[model samples]
Target: MATVSMSVNGKLVSRDIDPRTLLVDFLREHLRLTGTHVGCDTTQCGCCTVHVDGKAMKSCTLLAIGLEGAQITTIEGLAKGQELHPMQAAFREHHGLQCGFCTPGMIMAAVDMVNRKGNHLDDQTIREELEGNICRCTGYHNIVKAIHSGAEAMGAAK
Candidate 1:
């Protein structure tokens, strides 16, 4: 077993895990942060998206041992107590989800997009950025609207 230490959701955690453990498995199985789903373990789907050092990443594509000391943020980390993150609220208000399997990854990716590209995201940009995250249920119309509105709300909040 290899020992790895990282800050997850603002909390420092260290675990002794197998050298090949994926970040998604580490978060879900070890830490019980089930908010990060495992839709496609091969990274073809963005269902395992999370924030690694403030950037959106496919958790399933990363090994937990390689991320020692990194700051990781899963979907569970996006909220403040009872309050939802702007993207999450926007997803809800805009009806951006159906089966809800992809919502967490979508929200995480959206937040990272706004952080990197600034809050004024155009529909084209949003659509392009979201190419990695797949939501088969909603057909992406409402999802695009949510990200746009959420980006605006995020800008306003700032």
Candidate 2:
């Protein structure tokens, strides 16, 4: 077993885990942060997306041991008590979700996109950035709209 320490959702946490434990499992099974879903164990699906050091990354592609002191943020971390993050709010307003299975990861990835690409995201840019994340329910029209609006809100917030 390997001891891992990191800051998750602004809290410092440590755990003794197997060396091969995926970051998604560590967040879900170990820390009980089940907001990060596991749709495809492989990286094809972005359901396990999370923010590692302020960047969007597939938790399934990373090992908990490798993230040592990284700062991790899941969907649960995006809000302040009852106040939703701008991206999350936008998704809800735009009806970007249907089954809700992929909402958390979609929100996480959207926030990261805004962070990296600035807040004024065009539809084309949003679509391109969301290539990794997939939504089986919504046809991505609403998702794109949400991301575009969310990006603006995020920029305004900043």
Kindly list the per-residue Cα lDDT of model 1 for residues 1-158, writing each as its tens digit: 98999999999999999999999999999999999999978887799999999999999999999998999999999889999989899999999999999999999999999999998999999999998999989999999999999999999987
List candidate 1 segments past 4 Å from native.
none
lDDT string for model 2 (1-158, tens) is: 98999999999999999999999999999999999999988897799999999999999999999999999999999999999999999999999999988888899999999888998889999999999998898999999999999999998888
Error of model 1, residue 91, in angstroms? 0.3
Global lDDT of each model? 0.95, 0.94
After superposition, candidate 2 runs with Cα above 4 Å error: none
Give the Å error, residue 31, model 2: 0.4
lDDT for position 89 in model 2: 96
- Give the range of the ten consecutive residues with the poorest summed lDDT in model 1: 38-47
